[model samples]
Target: MSKTKFMGSIGRIFIASFLLCLAVVVIYPLLWMVMNGFKSNGDMLSSPFSWPRELNWQNYVKAWNRGVSSYLTISILVTVTSTLTTILISAWAAYGLTRVAIPFNRLMTTLVLGGLMLAPAVALVPLVKLFQALGLYNTYWALLILYTAFRIPFCTFLIRSYMLDLPREVDEAAEMDGASPAATFWRVILPMCRPIIVSAVVLNVLFTWNEYLFAMVFTSGGDFQTLPVGLTSLMSKNGTDYPVVFAGMVIAAIPVVVLFFASQRYFIRGLADGMGK
Candidate 1:
């Protein structure tokens, strides 16, 4: 073999090995958690790292029946509702910011970007009190609105950055054909923004799915509790049942994992586009 070819092959092998090690590091914990989920309580305690001799699949059924099913439903509702609303509202905001002439647009963009700088904990106390006074505290509306509010700034930032890259001619073309602004946005801009939209949807899904603190503090009762809060509550009640707890964690993870893989292509493209700006 040529010396250059030999060196390139060696470099490829080294990079492959490094990435394999990284993948193992990332995947092992998830695999371990899944394994533990199939163990009995006693097995989990005694042989935490070992594979179960006989898989106790009963924990999944128990966990699901006891709490996960209801909490999963709540999570699905909150996540889907908040994400959809955030995308729609943010899309419009983004389109307007990019397409329309507005005074102090730079200042407005900075203000929206500043939302990500504020810590949720710093605002939680006042927010809770505000919700309480508004009669939305401890209700789905409180959590839904809070989630949407916190997420909108980021979503607007994401969609707006991507929208800037789109050709302005499309909007102009639609207008020349007698399309209204709303019609142009819905029929022209929206269709072309599918990749970024998918990215926004997946990202928001990840945030709203994995979110815990807001759900815990804002919503109580099984009726309003999302999966993370309900799972934490389940851990409190079944502290000793490691298998059940792990099972609950695993089950809670499935949807987000499914979402990530389903939209993997667009998610990466969106991240690239967002970062490129």
Candidate 2:
């Protein structure tokens, strides 16, 4: 073989091996969690690495009955509401910044970008006080509003980048057909933005679903707490049962994992193209 061809093959092999190792590093802990969740506490303590002698599905049942079910519902509700609202508001903001001819547009854009710099930790104390003052504390709306508000800046940045790269001919063509600006945005631009929209939605879902601090602080425990907070509560209740605790974790993780895999293509493309362009 030619020297160049041989070098290229070696490079491909190296990249493939590196990716395989990375995948194993990411997936192994999940595998261990699943395996150990079925084992008895004694088995997990003594032979943690080994598969259970018998599958203990009851662990899942106990975990679910303990609050995983309610937690899952709360998580779903907050994730869906927050993701949709964040994407919609961000997409509209992006469209306005890219398509409109408003004064001080650059200043507005900078202000939106400034939100990305604010640390959630820094805002937590004031947010708690504000929510309590507004009587929104211990409510689902508290989480929904927090997730949407904090995420909009990053989402708008992604979408605005993607929108700036779009062909202008489509907008002109729609305008010649007498389409209003709102219609052009709703019907033409949004349809074309499917990849980034899906990407942003998936990203928002993962963030809101896994968020813990706000969920723990904003909501009084019980039906209102999301999966993360509820899972922590489960840990306290099942302090001695490691298997059951693991089962709760596995249950908590499945939805986000499914969402990521289902939209893996759009998620990667949206993030890459949104920034790359």
Candidate 3:
């Protein structure tokens, strides 16, 4: 074989090996956690690495009865509401920034994108005061509002980047057909931006589902807790029930994992397309 061909083969082998190792590293812990959920506390303690002798589904039942069900419901509600709100607002903002000739366009873009710089931690104190005064504290609206607000900047940045790469002729064509600005956006641009929109939805869903800090702080426990915070509470309350805790965690992780895998093609393509621009 030629020297260049030999080196190319070596490079491909090296990359494949590296990726195999990375996949194992990422997947093992999740598999272990799932296995642990099927174990009893004693079994897990005795043989952390061994397969469960018998799949004890009772742990999952106990977890569900103990509060995982309620937490799961709340999480789904918040994730869905926040994701929809964030995407709609972000898509509109991106369309305006890219397609519309709004006043102070550059300044508007700067201010909207500038939100990425503001850390969520820094706003916690003021947000608490504001929410309490507005009677939104300890309510679902608080989570809904915060999740949408914080996520909009990043989502907008992604959609806007993707929109910027779209051909301006589409806009002109839509206008020539006597479509209004809103009609053009809905019919032409938004449809063309499907990849990025799906990407943004997946990303936002992941964030809203897994988000703990705001979920914990904004809502008092019981009915309002999301999966992350609820998992912590489950751990604390059931510290001795390790298997149940594991089960709760497994339950929490399943949706996001499934969602990502289901939409992975669009997710990767959207990110690549957006970033390429």
Candidate 4:
């Protein structure tokens, strides 16, 4: 091959090697967590890297009994509810902002985008008070609202950017056929925006699933604590049970990791479309 082609091929190999190494780095912790979850407390601390000669499935049972099972259910509820609302509300808002021209559209978009700049830490106090007054404090509703509100700006931005890349011809054609804006959005726009929607849904799932701060603060007690918050309490109460803690961590990670792998294609497509434009 010519020098140029040879250099290009070498670059490709280097990029592939870097990516493979990156994947290993990212996945190693998860692999270790899974392995340790099958180990006894002594084995976990004794040989952290080496595989066990005998698998101890009892760690998972102990972890489950020590609150992981309940925490997992709570995490699933919060993640699913928060993600669904975030996507629906944000997608509708984005489609409206991009397609429907109203007065001060730019100002509205800026205001919404400005939400992205505000740190959640700054709003935590007021959010707590607001939820308390609204009687939503320390409940799934509190978590759902907080997660949805916090996630809106990014989701709106992503969905809006993706919608911009969609062909305007589809909208015009739908309009010419006497389709209303709502119909056009639902029938024509939504289908085309599926990739971004999937990406947004997955992103929101990851966030809401793994969230600890808000879940810790907004929820004080009762049936309100999410997986992260619950896991912390579980760990504190069972600090000596290293295997159980590892198992709980693994359980907490499994759903989001599985969902990410399942939706990775659409996630990548959405990211590419949103960023490429």
Residue-level lDDT tens digits of model 2 in 1-277: 9999999999999999999999999999999999988999899999988989999999999999998898899899999989989999999999999987888999999999899999999999999999999989898889999999999999999899999999999999999999999999999999988889989998888889889888888996536999888877765543568898899999989988898899999889888888898
> Model 3, which residues run further than 4 Å from truth?
237-239
Model 4: runs farther than 4 Å from truth? 237-239
Cα RMSD (angstroms) for every candidate in the order listed: 1.7, 1.4, 1.1, 1.6
Rank by lDDT (best first): 3, 2, 1, 4
Task: Provide the lowest-lDDT 10-residue window in model 2.
Answer: 231-240
Cand. 1 Cα-lDDT: 0.89
Better of 2 and 3 by lDDT: 3
Report the error of model 3 at residue 68, Å.
0.6
lDDT of 3 by residue, 115-227 (tens): 99999999999999999999999999999999999999999999999999999999999999999999998899999999999999999998899888999899865469898
lDDT of 3 at 197: 95
Decide which is better by lDDT, 1 or 3. 3
Better of 3 and 4 by lDDT: 3
Give the worst 10-residue stretch by lDDT in candidate 3: 231-240
Q: Residue 43 deviation, candidate 4, in Å?
A: 1.2
Candidate 1's clash total is 0
Best by lDDT: 3
Predicted model with the maximum TM-score: 3
**Cα lDDT, all candidates:** 0.89, 0.91, 0.93, 0.87
Query: On residues 1-277, what C-alpha lDDT tens digit does candidate 1 reach at each position?
Result: 9999999999999999999999999999999999999998888898899998888889999999888999999999999999999999999988888888789888888888889898899999999899989999889899889889999899998889888989989988999999998999999988888888999899899899989899988886637888888887666553568799899999999998988898899889878987588
C-alpha TM-scores of all predictions: 0.94, 0.96, 0.97, 0.95
Residue 94 in model 2: shift from native, Å? 0.5
